[model samples]
Target: MNKQFIVNLPVRQLDKSKAFFSALGFSFKAEFTNENAAFMIVVEDCIYAMLTTEPFFQSLTGKPVARATEANEVVLCLSCESREEVDSLIAKAAAAGARIPHPAEDHGFMYDQGFEDIDGHLWNLVWTESQA
Candidate 1:
């Protein structure tokens, strides 16, 4: 069986959040986008992130949305094709107003870097090499 993964996140402003990810080269599905939420396509049809306005998100969950800056909820990680891709993405993110929380780490076969988006969501870009 085939399955798709969708992660939902609460954002203070839908348009701002959309622009942030767009600057990183991610596109949205028009059928799934609206004023209250934007469906960001992470990997074709397999992976997607729903960036919903805080109020809209709260309406669905009936709970308070966690302030990503003040608390840790989830860290969204994406695999990169190469170390250069990882660095390039980080640069784009930073240029788009993301904050680099820490320096990139090189662990022999693996390299990774992290950034906080406009809404303070943590995201990590990683590249791994097979040691065969």
Candidate 2:
């Protein structure tokens, strides 16, 4: 059987968040999406990101949602097929209103870059020589 992975994040504005990710070339699963949450398809059916309203998220976790802008919450890393793919994804993220925290890094064997989304969530895109 194929394994699936999911990550949940809190967002202030569901519509805007969906729009932002949509602009970055992501699609949502309608069956798992609604007014309070959006199931973002990160890698077809294998990987998903559940973007939930802050209130809904708080209800689920019964804790204060992290202020990702001012504090560190989590850093999500995704693997890419090539260095150019990483750069390309970053460009799309920038155009979609995400913040590019820093420039890409090359470590001979690894290349990586990251961006902060509209809700201040950090997403790292990485590529490795071994992946090629």
User: lDDT of all predictions, in order shown?
Assistant: 0.94, 0.94
**Candidate 1 Cα outliers beyond 4 Å, as residue runs:** none
Model 2 residue runs over 4 Å out of place are none
Question: Alpha-carbon error at 18 in model 1, in Å?
Answer: 0.6
Worst 10 residues of 1 by lDDT: 123-132
Candidate 1 local distance difference test against the native? 0.94
Residue-by-residue lDDT tens digits, candidate 2, 1-132: 689999999999999999999988899999999999999999986999999999999999899999899898889999999999999999999998999999999998999999999999999999998745
Clash number for candidate 1: 0
lDDT tens digits by residue: candidate 1, 19-112: 9999999999999899999999999969999999999999998998999999989999999999999999999999999999999999979999
**Clashing pairs for predicted structure model 1, backbone only:** none
